[model samples]
Target: MTKSNNSATLNLQYGGGFRMSSVIPVIRKFNRFYTNVLGLLDQHLLETDFSLSEARVLFEIGHTDRCTAKMLIDKLRLDAGYLSRILKRFEEQDLIYRIQSDEDRRLYYLRLTDRGRDALAKLDARSDDQIRLMIGHLPEQAQRNIAKNMAAIENALSDDPQIRQEVRIRCDLKPGDVGSLIHLHGWIYAKECGYNHVFESYVCQTFVDFFKHYSPDKDRFWFAEAGDEIVGAIAIVGHPDRRAQLRWFIVHPEYRGLGLGKRLLQESLQYSKEKGFRRVFLETTEDQKTAIAMYERAGFRKIAEHENHLWGVHHIEQTYELQLP
Candidate 1:
């Protein structure tokens, strides 16, 4: 109906998609922090005669020995020409060795030399120390809070079987990301259960508080990623009373109806069993019937039913428990 713009047809066929400008600035900020503020680039340039790109290659090889050249290309998504140039530079520097795999002569695998290993250690220590310093600036409680929020953010952007190119799970959560997760959760719950305005700040804050106080070594969080995007998550926290608490179980709306929630619950349950937990427990509202059914399917039995006047007058509460093997 309307006249076209300067570009070609704006149809979805050609993969013309919407772009978020906010992400670019954040990436640029981190780039500056690593190169200019942290002096990471300067450190590598001064200590070794290697450029930043070469240093990254060496670090990757040092951390994961015998990685194929194709592996790096796929993982890092680097341009073949650029990667080849960096590999050649590292090869010239004697920091890495490349060999044709015995089984596949066409496949070139890379290994870091002793010098490269030493360099990676230096980089790891410097990065860890810097992160520790930053965390140390906050109080212990605040550090834990940051770590939990960071973990949520990481879970949201994870790139595993659950999803790809999304949020990262199994990482430290940031300050604002949990709120974002809560907001995102609201949309998912609304879409899935036809319950609008159900997930709020109180629920998000409650789960965030639990994660911040809980010890991860005693517990673990499972998340699903679709193309590096965190579309689902499940947290299992072990209490001193020998009980495992399931909290903040959620999945993004785009990934719903795929049985991912069930898969995550199964994984958490198996993990709980492996960790020697005798039982797992969770709380939900009457409004979330599907989730309640999912819990039941996961072998969770209703342990308690009550009314909650604390949050709202119409709130009906139910607690479910699963006995672990």
Candidate 2:
């Protein structure tokens, strides 16, 4: 009998009344790729004594000076025992050190040694060079296509309810990320809110120009990323009058209706209050009924109205103000 080369062979039977299991074959193929081709399974088998898992733990420790075991478990999703073994192996190598928490002796904190830091840095450099070599072979459009497809797959996976429950919002706001927030907001308004490109373009330009004249220390931006993809964002810029101007609030269409937008708004307001702002204000079109309502519910009151040319006509721009407690 001859072995079949047809793609449809995956669905055919190799035995009596029993179809061949495709899963095992696929897993084996992946194992071969990761072990032989990618050289990930035991790439450092002779060069280094650490397993892949141990190397990963060292990498995480090198990135942050102080991290608790719980933080590492949460970030990597590794089983407690598995992570413990890896930690122990690194400790034996004197590559990492752990200390018991003074407050809770049961809790352990981990940090990398100088040797571990140097090792992790070399690993990062090697990984970067490897990716650059592989991606360099692809054309610009092909690379973009890979990025788009990967993003779509990631967003789809994050939509799972089980995964959503584990997602956490990050509070740190960095400069230049405000531009990303502005882009997201404009894109959401144009796509989900059914506005035209004119409104989005104008709003984006307004945000860019506003950030240029204003210092970022006086301004704040926040973003929510689920496994490295930006799902939502918001920003508050300081007005010359000492008021916090809320702007560029947006949640991706995939993440909307999940209360992420409300969360971002609440956090932004809280950050503004902490920064010594007495009052907060924002402007939105009358058509943004849901957003306007949310602002009102959050103690913001409509103070004035104006015309917005970006709306392509005379659109009512409602300004909402909230007094910080």
Candidate 3:
């Protein structure tokens, strides 16, 4: 059966039935196992005098730019009184200091003291060492599986029903951005789609042409980021006659099968529409059957085709065009 191209149509079943009722114990079991593995039940985390909650407070203080008691309360969802006691403990130990906000005297901002930084540093190192010791003996693949599963759990359990939180989308480009995207295209296509260096060169040349006539107001590119890495990309480059070309649509194999491709395509099409492009079109080889199918589902029709072997592959290059509303 053919699945819907729109990700919103892919529903995850939910209920309070026997199957759902049975899942709680299994989830709790995994939670217990993980907590034990991390030694969270220990009176002191990483053999430090601080409890897990206290260590987490310190870690949050160290990482946050605008540290505040209220922010911590909101983030940790801790009782005001409980957080106040923790703050008092930190102050007594000279781990953190507070300064009154200039605009609001009652609003105090938390800052880590030298002692606090040192303690946090030790806690960070110890936590890293602990995880290393736990996973060090496992094979590299096993280690990756653990990390991947962890991400999957977070994405699945998020309060938002949409899968969008699993990836970040941005239209802004900075220095070295194009090079990184081009490199991603080169490596990902080479590894997964059986494309070669010649294809990479073609990608480079396309970017070169793109930059030569780049316009921020009319042309736009979207990047899909997952955990600090760019996993997918799509671009809409404006042309004459109210037309726009979609280009550089690719997603990393590790992050595929997660609706990122559909989302990226939708973003590009939306941008093209906003840019007043009456027609949106893309050039792709027939080997990209899956992407072609998605385009077809999204109302794109094959406008032209040509036999091309320029990218070290003998394939029919197809031009798919979609009329915008």
Candidate 4:
């Protein structure tokens, strides 16, 4: 079946289960509210002669490298005929020009003229001014929260990999880092491992215990962040006899497969070695095959396993240890 038909059939089958009757209205309301807030319903955008779609096309042409009609169509999901007309108008207005690609004679590259750049700049300034006017009265924290939430929405809806690549890794623990990490552990484990609130309580207690003897010289935390959000984290806890334990290593699900988990683990191991810890070990369940493989590749050998009835599940708890040279 075609994609649209398949989607329709799936929606019919699962729509009730997902409570679409309630969810659909909420989404539609948000769409209407956002469009109105941005004055997208107006014939002209930002009081300019350019329509909303025309302004977007102009902006993308200016910013995108080696822009083309095909790229615009794919990025914006615009109709070919509509986009062609817009491009034709832009050419007539001397706002844009096209050049044939040397490698492909039939393929043409789009570029914005000086006038087009000026138009886009005006649109950008207007957009910024509109947003500033909307949120400028809010507290500084509220403004920051707005931007962070918007980034989150974009990350959830966008197919662009660039959003995931903007993660920053840091070793400093801030005021709310532990609480956020605990929340992440609870949410991620429940979603991925069917763990219950008991598991979350266990994580909380672990942090409580870790803090009892937390030494700045011995313990280290590495957090991978995007904007004001923590997407991944790892920590190494010092123990007696020059031994250390790697704990609380995790990456947000959406931020995985970007080598973030590997980076966090490496940071912990390197910190362990730098602290002159002779042995580094970690405890994890056998169900975590991906993490287990990563541990093995990092020269850790599984030395122990036991059946455990905890976290609302039956699982084999395993210990892996690495001896540093």
TM-score against truth, every candidate: 0.48, 0.51, 0.55, 0.85
| Candidate-wise lDDT, in order | 0.70, 0.73, 0.83, 0.90
| Cα error of candidate 2 at position 41, Å | 14
- Residue 125 lDDT in model 1? 73
Higher-ranked by TM-score: 3 or 4: 4
Candidate 1 least-lDDT 10 residues: 5-14
Compared with the true structure, what per-residue lDDT tens digits does model 3 show for residues 220-270? 989888655677889899999999999989887756777889989988988
Q: Is candidate 1 or 4 superior in TM-score?
A: 4
> Clashing residue pairs, candidate 2?
none
Best by lDDT: 4
**lDDT for each residue of candidate 1 in 1-325, tens digit (9 for 90 to 100):** 3435312333432344444553565456556754674474356445656565665666778766579777777767788999998888777877788888899888878988787677778777766776776578788887877666665655456564443233444534546555556776776655554444534656667776776776767767766654334577887888876789997788776566667788788878887888888989999988888889899888899999898655423577899999877
Off by over 4 Å in 3: 1-165
Q: Write the per-residue lDDT of candidate 2 for residues 273-297, one digit (tens) a residue.
A: 8888889999888888888888988
Model 2 stretches astray by more than 4 angstroms:
1-151, 154-159, 165-168, 171-179
TM-score, structure 2 vs. true: 0.51
Better of 2 and 4 by TM-score: 4
What would the per-residue lDDT of candidate 4 be over residues 1-325, giving only the tens digit for each residue? 6869857766775677566565676577678878876674343363787888898899899999889999999999999999999999999999999999999999999999999888889888887776787899999999999899889989989898887789999998899999999999999998889999999999999999999999889999999999999999999999999999999999998898989999889878888888899999999999999999999999999999999887898989999999998
lDDT of 3: 0.83
Which candidate has the top score in TM-score? 4
